[model samples]
Target: MQILITGGTGLIGKQLCKALLAEGHELTVFSRNPASVPAKCGAGVHAIGALGEWHPGKTFDAVINLAGEPIVDARWTARRKQVLWDSRVTLTKELVRHIATAGRKPAVLISGSAVGYYGNRGDTAMYEAADAGEDFAAQLCKAWEDAAHAAEQVGVRVCLLRTGLILSNKGGLLGRMLPAFKLGLGARLGNGKQWMSWVHIDDYVAMVLKLLHDSFASGDQASLALASGPYNMTAPQPATNAEFTAALAKALHRPALFAAPAPLLRLAMGERAGLILEGQKVLPGKMTAAGYRFQYPNLDDALGNLFGR
Candidate 1:
């Protein structure tokens, strides 16, 4: 398969590209800095500065839309929010537009969404069937998914991967937390009762492969209908914030002796703190029902695999 990926330099995109390349798939990393793909994704893969840079005759078997600004990197100021919105909502629209005009459309468009679509549900468990909330994150995901679904009108199969917290040693949430945990400064956020739905990066990448392969088999309406739309790319088992903190502390042989109060977090991070203090217990109902098996179903195994504990 020849796959075109946006945000190929991101944590998940980098690993996904490496894995797909190893599987004998041809790749093209679409980026603002095409030259950086060689340093980030290594050789053999093609890189184009923009979709416009591609020759009119060039096409792809699949287009994975993963380009988006990091939501949690900064406090949710008006400017920051616009950047986040434009990166995802705007960029995805452009990708879909290109697909609409392409001489040869891709078989499937695997667009990125997030578990944040459900909003801060406290301890409530969320599935693909759940109605989305009205928060900024949820609204953002809805718009993002809407843009990707436009390809379906052109006969391209669409998969909206509502991914959870990706746990990997290479980078992402776990990488950012490791130094503090290793230094014994790790602490629970708020009361630590909020549910955190997560997946091992390896399993997350595998889910994409599963969906990509399944698209080929989704010839008739029945098979195609069963596989498309919002798939919660999360583990079967969801953990509370307290359980996750304890497990990380135990894995690192460090003491989780402090608790960061919710009020302080809100004060420090403003609205962005809601992402840390409030979470949904998302379940991969559709993905699992479709026969995708998880490599690390439990938090312990996932942490162990990443930290070598």
Candidate 2:
């Protein structure tokens, strides 16, 4: 299969590309830095600096949309919020436009979203059928998903990935926290009761592969029929912030005796602090129901694997 992927230079995109390549699929990455994509994603990946390059003459069997600015990297000032919105919602809208004009529509669009769509729901378990949240992050995800859904009108199957905190040694949430935990300065945030819905990087890639290959044949009783809808790309079991902290500390043979108060986080991060201080207990309801098995279902096992314990 021929696949066109946006944000192919990102952490998840890079890993997904490697998996797709290993499966003998041809990949073309749409990147802002096309030259860097081959080096970052892998060799043999065709890189395009502009979306315009995907004209009507060009065709792709599938399109993967994962382009987005790092949401929690900086304070959510008015300008920063727009940057986030443009990177995700606006960019997706444009991608859909391209798909609409394509001479041959792709079979499916595996677009990126986030569990943040559920807002800061304390302990309420979120599924694909749950109502969307009204916070900034939630609204952002909602709009992003909505944009991708437009592809349905053009007869393209759309899969919305409501991704969680992806744990990998390369670079992600774990990469940022490893230094602190290794020095034995690991700390829980706020009261540490907020849920942390997460998935191992390997499991995430496998899930994507399943979605890409699963039969989408309509009215075929034998097919998995994973045609279209939102998928919570999280592990079956979720852990509280405190549990995750302890697990990380234990994995690194460190002590977690400190707490970053909510007030301090808010002061330092402003609105962006909500991303850290609040969370949803998102379960991979759709993925598991579709018979997808997780490589790292438990927090301890995932951390231990990453830390080589």
Candidate 3:
């Protein structure tokens, strides 16, 4: 299959591209810098600086939309918020427009979203059927998914990946925490009770491959039902902040003796701190029901794998 991926330079995107290429799929990565794309994405992947760079009549078998600004990088000032919205919502609109005009429409569009679509629901287990919250994250995900869903009208199967915290050794939430925790400065946030829905990078990539495979096999009437709607790309078990901290510290052979108070966090990060202090216990209902097995379903196993413990 020929797959076109936006944001193919990102942490998850790079790994996904390599995996797809290894499986004998042709890859075209849409990148901001075409020159750097080869270095960033490695060989066997074509890179385009702009959508217009593609030939007018060219089309992909599938489109994976993962282009977006890093959500928790900085304070969510008005400008920062706008950047986030434009990167996700605006980029998605453009991708859909490309799909609409393509000579051969892609069979599937796997768009990225977040479990934050459920907002800070505390302990309430989130599922695809649950209503989204009214918060900014929720609103952002809703718009992102809605934009991608537009392709369904073109007879394209659309799947929204409501991703959670992605755990990887190279870079992501866990990477940033390693240096501090190695020095025994590991700490929990806001009493460490908030639920954290996270996934190992391996499982994340596997789920995506599964979805793409389903799309490839779904050309017939019976198989067409295999890929549709939102699929939560998280581990089966959702870990709390405290549990995550404990497991990471154990894996690192470090002491988790510090706690960042909620007040301090809020003062430092402003509204962005809510992401750490408040979280939802999201479940991968759709993925599980569809028979997708997670490579790392628990915090302990995931941390152990990452830390080589």
Candidate 4:
């Protein structure tokens, strides 16, 4: 299959591209720094500086949309919020427009979303069918998904990946917390009771590959049935922030003995702090029912795999 991917140099995109490349699938990556794509994503990846490069004559079997600003990297000032919105929603809208005009439309569009779509639901279990939250992050994800859903009208299968916290040896939520955990400065945030839906990077890549290949490539009725719509890209067993902290500390042979108060986090991060202080217990209800198996369902197992313990 020939694939075009946005954010192909990102954490998840890098790994996903490697997997696709290993399977002998041709990949074209859209990047701000087109020259760096071959170095960052891998050799043999054709890089495009703009979506316009994909002329109407150009064709792709599949399109993976993962471009977005790092939501937690900076404070959510008014400007920063707009940047987030434009990067995801605006880009997706443009991608769909291009898809509509394509001489040969892709069979499927695997677009990115986040578990933040559920907002601060506390212990309430969220599934793919759950309603959108009213918070900024949730609204952002809803609009982003809505933009991607436009491809369906053109007869393209659309899959929205409502991803959770991804655990990997490289950068992500785990990368940001590893330094502190390794030094035994690990602490739970806000009382540590907020539920966290997470997935190991390996499982994340595998699930995506399944959707790309099985859902559209193969003519399996079950696969086609599960091909479109939202999927909670999360592990089966959700954990609390406290449980995640303890598991990481245990995997690193360190002690966790402190807490980051919610007030301090709010003062430091402002509205962005809600991302940490509040979370949803999202489950991969659709994925599981679709017959996808999880490689790392437990928090301890996922951390152990990452730490090689």
lDDT of each: 0.90, 0.92, 0.89, 0.94
Which TM-score value belongs to model 1?
0.97
lDDT of 4 by residue, 76-188 (tens): 99999999999999999999999999999999999999999999998889999899999999999999999999999999999999999999999999899989999999999
Candidates by TM-score, descending order:
4, 2, 3, 1
Stretches > 4 Å off in candidate 1: 218-222
Write candidate 1's Cα lDDT for 1-309 as tens digits.
Answer: 888999888999999898898899999999888888978886988898877765547788899999999999898989999999999999999898888888898999999999999998877778898988789999999999999999999999999999999999887888888898899999899999999998999999999888887887744666667668899999999899899999999989899888999999999999989898989999999988887879999999999888887
Q: What is the lDDT of residue 113 in candidate 4?
A: 99
State model 3's lDDT: 0.89
- Candidate 2 global lDDT: 0.92
Candidate 3 residues lying further than 4 Å off, grouped into runs, are: 218-222
State which candidate has the highest TM-score: 4
Error of 1 at 43 (Å): 0.6
Question: By the TM-score metric, which is better: model 1 or model 4?
Answer: 4
Model 4 TM-score, 2 decimals: 0.99
What are the clash counts of all predictions, listed in order? 0, 0, 0, 0
